[model samples]
Target: MAQSFGTFDIAVLDGGQYDPRWPLIHMTPEEAVRAADDMGVKSMILTHVGKFCISAHSWDEPFNRVVEASQGKDFRLLTPKIGKPIRLDGAEQSFSRWWEDIN
Candidate 1:
């Protein structure tokens, strides 16, 4: 979906990879960031996370990894709460690192 955008304002990507085998199916957090950076996306959102157990890592791993991987990178990662609204009017937005506090 995102790859075909050429250049876009935002990208909503799934931050999951069941395992190494499925990374090609769905991107890992790092891969998503790379893709967004390569595509020149200014803002990116990670969805389909903390809701599944396809991989061996912790549920918050994707969120944490994405944040780590995005440092000094070209895009902003938006981790919006479920069922919440995020204003996309080109205004810079900040979201709580909701996954980090988990035990």
Candidate 2:
């Protein structure tokens, strides 16, 4: 359906798991934003979030940081519900702040 919806963008980096950038594990939020920008990505989707206590910085901290860093950046941040299908019709996508509803 590239002809139908049009090609949106390339690259979806994992922008979570922690900071420091050592041990070469996962890309932090800030780092991910930078990388995406450098790669000239137009849109990004951050998923697999809202896990229970994976890191010490709360369940939603990393995701929060990603949102903060994405502002004024080159690409758009798309936070869809985990396991949900997101239609890429070249139209703007909106998602509810599910984390805010958490206890």
Candidate 3:
């Protein structure tokens, strides 16, 4: 789908459960990152993190790891705070609205 669309950027919401049998509701963080990189996607943002990953108070760890893994590569990983705007110059893309409540 990315090839057909030729999209430069992609966002994965609730993507922390890559394994279908993991008893989680989303894709694994690593799998999501790898898939994005393999697809030649230039940027990826992870969302919909589950309570299990957050109650531990280290939800950002996995996010940071994905970002580090994509460093110096064509892919740029980001975890934007709700309501912040993200702009991509060459792509002419602007992501201004986040969650509705925050916006």
Best by TM-score: 1
| lDDT-better candidate, 1 vs 3 | 1
Give the runs in model 1 whose Cα sits over 4 Å from its true position.
1-6
| Lowest summed lDDT window (length 10), candidate 2 | 47-56
lDDT of each: 0.79, 0.70, 0.57
> Candidate 2 vs candidate 3: which has greater lDDT?
2
TM-score of each: 0.83, 0.77, 0.57
User: Candidate 2, residues 1-103: lDDT per residue as tens digits?
Assistant: 3455554485577766664645376777777777777766778875435665455557787678888888997677877767666767777668776677778
Residue lDDT tens for model 1, 23-89 = 5677888888887888888789886688768678777888889999999986778887666788789
Model 2 root-mean-square deviation = 5.2
Worst 10 residues of 1 by lDDT: 15-24
Candidate 1 has an lDDT of 0.79
Candidate 3's error at 85, in angstroms?
1.2
Distance from true location, Cα of 99 in model 2, Å: 1.1
**Model 2 ranges off by over 4 Å:** 1-8, 19-23
Indicate the TM-score of model 3: 0.57
